[model samples]
Target: MYYGGYYGGVGGTWFLILMPALLLAMYAQLKVTSSFNKYLRVQSGSGYTGSEVARIILDRNGLHDVRIEQVGGNLTDHYDPRSKVIRLSRNVYNGHSVAAVSVAAHEVGHAIQHDEGYFPLILRNNIAPIASIGSRFVWILILLGLVISPFLIEVGILLYVAVVLFQVITLPVEFNASKRALYQLENGIVYRDELDSSKEVLNAAALTYVAATLVALGQLLRLLSIFGRRRD
Candidate 1:
């Protein structure tokens, strides 16, 4: 029997490779929630709402033309480079808490990245659309390849690699953004005590990206193992 026959089998090599990634991803998600909740309760000494903090950072950086808008949903804050706008979630837009301020500043970090033509930021943006479309078709192609043609399996692997690459690029973008946020906050936006709390929130958020990258890597390894067996 071709080793491809064992594809998706339970308690095999696949299980060993995937277990750690799954665990890390779960832990990262929990930590992000915990840190966000904890810091959300702590108000900033600067008493600036998240929107105000974002506006201040943008203006100080000569981004006065950039617009700040309130967005709905939890933790949906983002900087839309195409729109040249920063969209803060409802809580962050009006709340004067450490969590709110840190998140607000982080989005502005992306805006800064765009203004400066950050390499990884630009690469990630270009890769995002391919990864998005590839994600939906990977499993289908893999399953079909298992029964039809090994060439399809190879295509699936290539697509999965692209996704992993996107995740890899995302890590630096997020970390740099978080670092920028902390540095900006430490300058004058928050008191000494509040600085640590903001760090905690950003650090937890960073872990999520780490976990995502790990998961993507693990999945790619799993696919290679399964498909390699068929070739052998």
Candidate 2:
């Protein structure tokens, strides 16, 4: 009878387990931001701006048509497949810091993947909307089921699976981006000195994805445990 409460599930353990990862993610994010800002002030000795790095990288990958444009903000860089544009945040686009070059080059990696039609990247783009919808329903369905019939719980379980699938798919896409960024850095397309710093920043960034996946996995497990306890 006491276990009837949905909170009786793996909620506590799930949170506890993910607590450290969440803390680490926060720390990593802060470190990256601090480092980026710090490097932002250190002018690049090579005189190559973010757009210049992006241009050369895209040209190398035969994505010469992908326009690299500067948008306002910090760390707001991304590659838009729809517009065929690589949008670089103001600081990254115009600055000649290690942060600028690294962030800019990383976005170009996505463009390269698009040009070559990478499978994981393709899968991620396709499933993103479905996953977004599923996430919107997951919490409500799951919590509602906990307070009502077990059937709602089952529905929530199915929905959470969709979210997890997206998380799994994202791992490859992100890792590949970092790998490509590193490759570009090593090839002299971007420059050294910033190599270690870029690597550190990217490494921190990657942990965010890992944290997200782990959170999803925890939720999936929580749903499974709820179902299991219902049976028992």
Which one wins on TM-score?
1
Write model 2 residue lDDT over 57-149, tens digit each, in one string. Answer: 888888868998889777778898888999999888888887788888889989998888999988888877878877888778767777787
Model 2: worst 10 consecutive residues (lDDT sum): 1-10
Which lDDT value does model 1 have at 2? Answer: 49
Residue range 190-223, candidate 1, lDDT tens digits:
8888888888899999998988888887788788
The lDDT leader among the candidates is 1
Q: Stretches of candidate 2 above 4 Å error?
A: 1-13, 226-232
Regions of model 1 farther than 4 Å from truth: 1-14
TM-score of each: 0.92, 0.84
lDDT value for candidate 2?
0.80
